[model samples]
Target: MDHIKKVGVIGSGTMGAGITQLMVQNGCATVLFDIDKETVDKAKESIGSRLERLVEKKKISTEEMILAKELLQTTTDMNMFKDCQLVIEAAPEKIEIKRSIFQQLEKICAKDTVLTTNTSSLSITEISGQIENPRRVAGYHFFNPAPIMPLVEVVQGLQTAPETIEVLVQFAEGLNKKPVVCKDTPGFIVNRVARPFYNEALRIMNDQVASVEQVDRIMKSAGNFKMGPFELQDLIGIDVNFATTQSVHASFYGESRFRPHYYQERMVQSGSLGRKTKGGFYNYD
Candidate 1:
């Protein structure tokens, strides 16, 4: 944990920005970077507004809010990450983009510095293979709204050293997060075990066992899930959810249980991409 005083977050969209916010909230100095300057600025503004909400809700004192804002350094320059001890990449879900970033980070950061990715579906080994120090690179995946989410998946690649995992678990705990160490298997733990919930729910809907609304209601009441598959899909973005399912399915080599639902693909194609698009299985407006 002491090795993580300075953190660097690449990408400024939802996940990257959220990770940066969490690091700052944990009293770590964070440098946020994106290819686009405006995006980085937007990420900063979004975090600022979230901190203000915490202030209004009395979750954090005004002084803490000020300090939170001060801990983050949002920028478009990649070189600023040179001094960071740990850098977490949250770029698009493309292997090439990740490889490029890791190669560049290897050049910029110290040889002993730690590097991790927030990739949900990609194989950690495949990503780390792009860099020189695969031993120092591992997967540090976080659920959305990172600061609020307690669970973090610490992925051990095929070549990941045990000491690295120990340090990562300690690092996550330092930020007051629960860390679950798992093999670099597809979907790690939660996404792999939870696939049946979504796949079966989608099958029920497609089979006309019930409508999306009714299924969601039943799941919430009977299954005790805070949100049902369709509803959660909508909130997570139909495309994003579908893509994750597909990736896991492919990673499993077309396993029957992990099959990607046809309805989900159709929804994504129809642009019913959840709350961000204002429409999905349910309507936003």
Candidate 2:
């Protein structure tokens, strides 16, 4: 963790920005990158606002917030990541896009710099296969709302080195996150175990066995889960959740247990992508 004084995060979306905030809060000099200057700037502003809210809530001192803001740097250039000891690619869940970003990072970063992906379901080995040093490529899958999520899946690809995994585990702990090591399996651990939670809820709603609200209510009251499947999907983005289910299902060669519900596809196609779009199983509008 001491060796990882600087970090870089790509994509500048919700997950990327969250990871950047976590890094800076933990005293790492962080560079948040995106292709669009406007997008990166927006992410920077959003992170700053979140830090301010934490200070207002007394979760963080004003001085801590100031230091965190100072530690953060936003950029539209990929070359700015050249000196980062660790780079976490929070790009979209596309194999080609992730691979391309890693390939570009391979050229820009130092040979020993650890490269990780925040992919929920993509194969880490495939993402790093084309790069020169696959041993340095691993998965650092943080849950949504990274600053609040305690568990981080430190995934080891077939080619990933033991040293790389150790470094990631220590780094995650340094960020005050609980790190669990897992192999480079599709959906790794949490997402794999959680598929049934979302899939069966969708199935129940699709079969008219229960309404979305009913299912969520039961899960919260009887199942004792913090958030019901439908509610969680809305928070996670219906499209993102559906895509993860599809990826896991396909990865298992169309296993029935991991099958996605048609209603999820319909929601995604309709562009009611959970809270972000103001609608999904429930409407925010």
Candidate 3:
């Protein structure tokens, strides 16, 4: 909203980096913040390489790539966000961490600055509950590999101003994303509806109805899914997917259908957290 030319992204992980890339590519000046300089430096290198790859693929011109890189900046200071028209928090999915960030953001950001969380499972209303001005806080959920994903969920908390939602929708579109406005329900839309795809697959495997390989093959071949549930889980990180399921289950008050299978929990406990850990439902080694 307000022709957001300067934006702040409060993380430097995969999602944050991708969001920053999207902002700069769209000609918005972006500041990426992290707790430490090492992380900020690494994200800068990763973003540079990604933009260069886009240029090599002819997806972007050399000049455009340079312009994007120039628009991007990094810092460890939260006070630097004073001028940001919008700040999207892509930090980890911890409530304390998020609440703390918002508390600080309330002091640093302008009153009109649209503060939003990219949390996939956390309740937007609850996340904004502690903010001084909850009206400006909302959810701006982006999927993994944000640069390639076109869909964005503009979630509205109970206290979120209607104009905030309107602003987020237009802001999403400015980055060439398809924005869908949704109530601040747990898991929102995709994560809630798509849970069965992963859970039932786990159930089937645990029940011996089929092996992991068989279930994956069937889902890909017969179901015509781009990636099998297991394959997708591996790519998404087993721990991450399991945490989302756990969060949904808790939000629903232990609904039977949303119950997490023991096998899934065991995978996280074993530290086989998918490709990031080099092992999960399948071994990458």
Q: Judged by lDDT, which candidate is best?
A: 2
- Stronger candidate by lDDT (1 vs 2): 2
Best of the candidates, TM-score: 2
Residues 1-285, candidate 3, lDDT per residue (tens digit)?
447989999999878998999889889999999999999999999999999999999999999999999999999999989999999999988889999999999999888899999999999999989877999999999987898899999999999999999999998987889999999998999999988999999999988999999999998899998889998899878888998999999999999888887898999999988887888888898
Pairs in steric clash, model 3: none
Cα error of candidate 2 at position 213, Å: 1.4
lDDT of each: 0.89, 0.94, 0.92
C-alpha TM-scores of all predictions: 0.96, 0.98, 0.96
What is the full ranking by TM-score, best candidate first? 2, 1, 3
Q: Judged by lDDT against the true structure, how good is candidate 2?
A: 0.94
Lowest summed lDDT window (length 10), candidate 1: 234-243
Q: After superposition, how far is residue 131 of candidate 2 from its true place, in Å?
A: 0.8
Model 2: worst 10 consecutive residues (lDDT sum)? 198-207
Q: How much does candidate 2 score in TM-score?
A: 0.98
Q: Which portions of model 3 miss their true places by more than 4 Å? A: none
lDDT tens readout by residue for model 2, 1-285 = 989989999989889999999999989999999999999999999999999999999999999999999999999999999999999999989899999999999999999999999999999999999999999999999998999989999999999999999999999988999999999887999999999999888888888999989999999999999999999999999989999999999999998999888889999999999998888888899
Misplaced by over 4 Å in model 2 are: none
